[model samples]
Target: MTRTATIIGGGVIGGGWAARFLLNGWNVQVFDPDPQAERKINAVLSNARLALPALSDVPMPVEGKLSFHDTIFDAVQGSEYVQESVSERIELKKKVYAQLQQANPGVLIGSSTSGFKASDLQEGSPAPENIIVAHPFNPVYLLPLSEVSGSPRNTTETVERTAQIMRDIGMYPLVIRKEIDAFIGNRFLEAVWREALWMLKDGIATTSEIDEAIRMGFGLRWGQMGLFETYRVAGGEAGMRHFMAQFGPALKWPWTKLMDVPEFNDELVDLVANQSDAQSGAYGIRELERIRDQNLVGFLRALKERNWGAGKVLRDHDAARAAVFHAQTDTAPKAEPLTMAHMQVLPGWIDYNGHMTESRYYFANSETVDAFLRLIGAGMDYVAGGHSYYSAETHIRHLGEAKLGDRLVGTIQIISADEKRFRSFVRIMKGDEVVATVEQLCLHVDMAAGKTVAASPEVWANLKAIAEGHAGLALPEGAGRAVGQKK
Candidate 1:
């Protein structure tokens, strides 16, 4: 419907959110105070320019325009949703929300703060009921998750409605049951980070070891399934109760500490940096990003065929995207072919240089003939049944340029036909002017013999009847040119 999404920041995350909405057909207006906002946005847009086009399942509508605004109020005037992604400070968010509310009371507002409660930011607002917290991770366009949490003071329906919009734009919207700082996903990450940091502080494992532990071992199991679901599977025949009875003691081991904040100092920083460099071998940020994208593409594509987990979501999204172009799934069947089913020129029939390649004209005429063959009882079904007509020789004469947008029609008249060999004269016309002509001799191919073979009895009868109807017509000048030219 050409909905308007107003973004109040142009940082990495904000720009990603912009790409998601814009790529899905929303007109976006951006309000950023940073002097380098446009530069940063351009960097994000460049990535999106390649990515969105490559994975798009169908033709996208025209690219959405991005407008820059000097102030949040000016930007939110007609916006459907005002995404406030300014500085993480509570005061800054409150100020932005105030500006948004003052501009438009009906507009829904979202803050991009990771751990801030909506109430803290919405307290001093006139329309606190419409403001919610929506925290998305880095590379927002690629990652599907959005931790959509909101305070009770906000309208619950509004938050739910906003989540639906997020889904429409291809996001995984997880609603926060309780308005808590550092919602579900980050809380899980924080728990793992705390334990990993403990190992580094004690010199028990290197940074590489911790990452390898996750990537190679249980990490993969929990990747497509959450910890609980994975454990449920592990329980196997005995299920959760029996499995927990046998292995729950490990949860209390001295090696695992639930609480320990490692002090951030030079030694700790160097420990992390050295271990990281050792693990990945000093890859640049861009290279790492490219690797991440390739891996995600591979993972997502594999998941699409099985229609499992996040892959199913991706599959559904692609289907929805395809609906734009493939709405004619049940359209009527194509027409039967006449005279070897000659076809006219399509848009890409020729190159930008404005001359049809000699090879392509023959192919186009052959396609038309193939369609007519289908009408005469030889089609893809016949080929699948181990029979086909293969062209052995052809002669073509190009009289003029087959320029772009030219509508050319082709006609094929059978000169002779038998079980072993058949000949046809193909002529191309632009209006009444003859652009080209082809005289092709084709062999009835036998798949098993890998050689010319006689046509089947049924095929011979059909061809004989069709040939007899046009027996009185004179052959074109180009006809019978194999042995000698008619001229």
Candidate 2:
């Protein structure tokens, strides 16, 4: 069944929620008084369309329907979930919640208030049990973290259901067990923000320098390992307790003015704004956003490869999506080899010759292998069970070059398969032109034992079925060719 989500605001965060839901195949209805709400939402969606899919090899679901409505009632009429992203004023939130409740008493309402407690928002409200805080970070469509919490009036079921809905849309829902003013993520952010403001106020560091201190230092570590774990490593052989005992005294030092907030006078505003301009004023907001998105995509993909933190969430979600895809198409006949994967040539894939580099062909072929593995039901659980396919050998034949911005598709043909080994050919195409071919030989391995082994019976059956399906097709021209020519 198709699900529906309604967004109450069309600002940056609201638009991001819309993109996340819409891209995940949820029909979206947006209500905002801003006359340009549609334009704003579409712009956010454009960036999302470019960045989000690059995080995974699995194909995304077809985009769901998007509609704009002027009245809040019209938008929330049939929505199963309503996300309120209007102004942060409590009065405004309460008003919106009232209207939302009136429109649909049974629907769950998630408010995107950064600082307001869910209990405060639910105060003096009918159906307060249905309202919960679902705070999300900026660029919501790309970032996976969504902090979920409930007010005192809210039932446990409300929060759990909200988290499930968030997971369905490819978000990591961190449920805050207790209601707090700013939830968890924003509290950490607020601390950093306050400290940064102090630095600016004291002339200790410029905006750029503060940003560098983060991006070049702890930021990278925090992206995957996070604070306690990163610090635990810093603690050395003794681990977290030893490190804390040694460095805990530094917490009392006057190195940080975290307890005090700088006054937001005009002079301070101008000072900060001027310094920010000097730091990054050259690039427009959109250009800066693109740069940020590209960097994030690259880092997230790296983490996905290692199956750590947010990358693990992405990997798990991709596996689920692949399962649904295989289930839906299970009855379909196998005619041509499966069009397993497709991707655009990102800028990083270009070489000195201004064409897609050789390494990317191998990467694309690996993704094709991943698709085939998923099709054969060899997924995370299969690998976790100490059974997996390891590439034993690969032979590549490059016939043409693909340039940056070119869209490439990979097609897979099963050549042969047995209990312990399998071989396949992947053809890389730019549109209809064949650009390259990769022949791969793989061995099933017992990961724990580090030795070759026969695949599970089910996996072998699936591979045999695929090999038989492709038997009628002509073998790829270069299927068994060697790297060297015959003497």
Candidate 3:
């Protein structure tokens, strides 16, 4: 059954929530008085469609329906969940919640308030348990963290439900143990923001310089290892304790003006704004958003490759979806090729020629073959058990070029197989056109002995069945072709 979510306030964060839900197959009902809400959301969705799918190894779900409504009642009609991203006024939020609860009393409502605690939002509410903090970072469609903070009134079940909804939408929910203002992420950001303001006032650095200080240095470490872990690594051989002992006395130093407040004045505002404009005003907001999205996709993908931090959440999401895909193929093996993997041509896959690089073509083939290996019960687990298939000889034929932003499908056909060895063919397809082909000979191996070995009976049974199904099919075109040979 398809689920529905209602988004109140179609601004940046709200539009991001809408895209996140809609792309994850939740029908979205939006209620925003702004006449430009649809346009803004569409713009956000356009960026989302380009960026989110690149993070997935399996194909993303078909997008759900999106509808706009004039009234909160009309919007919250059948929505099981509601994400409120209105202006950060306590009264405005309370009014929105009243209207939402009146329409759907039992619906779970998550607020995207950066500072307001769940208790504060819950004040004077009839259904306090239903309202919780689900603050997401900007570009909500890409970043996975959703700080889920709740008040004492919110039961464990409510918190769990909210967290599960976040996970379902490919978000990492860090549930705050206690209700705190600004939650976790924003509180840390608030400190950094204060320091940045002071630096501008003192002429310490320009906006561009502060940004570079982050992106060029610790920001990379913070992205992957986070604050404490990064500091722990800085501790070196003795670890965090030793490092803390060394730096503990520095806390008394007058290095930071975190406790001091800079006067709020027009001069400071112009000083920051003028410098920021000079730094990045060249690109339009949408253009800059696209650039940021592309860079994040690359960084997140690297983390996903290693199954670390936010990448693990992505991998877990893929695994959940892959379970469904694998279940569909659990029946009899088909006579024709099996479609095993779906991929997008990510930004990093292209070369100077603006086409996919040679190595990426091979990476595409590996993705297909790897999925096939998992299907036949010879995946990572089998390798972990000291027996696996190792590619011995391989031939690749590039029939056509694949460029950036193109969607590709990978299909595999079994050519021949036995208990000891098997030969397979893979095609990397762009729609109906074959962009490339890979044929490989593989041998089952005993890792400890480093020698070729016979296949396990269970694995062989699955592989042999697939091979037999493809026995009647003709050989794929260009199969076994040598380099420089005629087509």
Say which candidate scores most in TM-score. Answer: 3
Clashes of each: 4, 0, 0
lDDT (10s digit) by residue, model 3, range 1-487: 9999999999999999999999898999999999999999999999998899889877577689999999999999999999999999999999999999998999999999999999999999999999999999989999999999999999999999999999999999999988889988988998999999999889999999999999999999999999999999999999999999999999999999888879989999899999999999999999999999999999999999999999999999999976766565434588999997777676567899979999998898898888889888999999999998899999999889988668788899999999989999999999999999999998999999999988899999999999999999999988878999887
Which runs of model 3 end up more than 4 angstroms from their true locations?
A: 331-368, 375-377, 381-416, 419-459, 469-487
Candidate 2: what lDDT? Answer: 0.88
Give lDDT tens digits, candidate 1, residues 227-246. 88888889998888878998
Model 1, residue pairs in steric clash: 340-369, 341-368, 419-454, 419-455
104-208, model 2: which lDDT tens digit per residue?
888899988898988888898878899899999988998999999887788888999999999999999999988888989988988999999988898899999
Instruction: Name the weakest run of 10 consecutive residues (lDDT summed) in model 1.
Output: 328-337
Against the true structure, what is each candidate's TM-score? Answer: 0.68, 0.78, 0.85
Task: For residue 54, give model 1's deviation from the true position in Å.
Answer: 4.6
Clashing pairs in 2: none
Global lDDT of each model?
0.73, 0.88, 0.92
lDDT of 2 at 463: 83
Judge candidate 3 at residue 301 and give its lDDT.
95
RMSD of each: 9.0, 5.5, 3.5
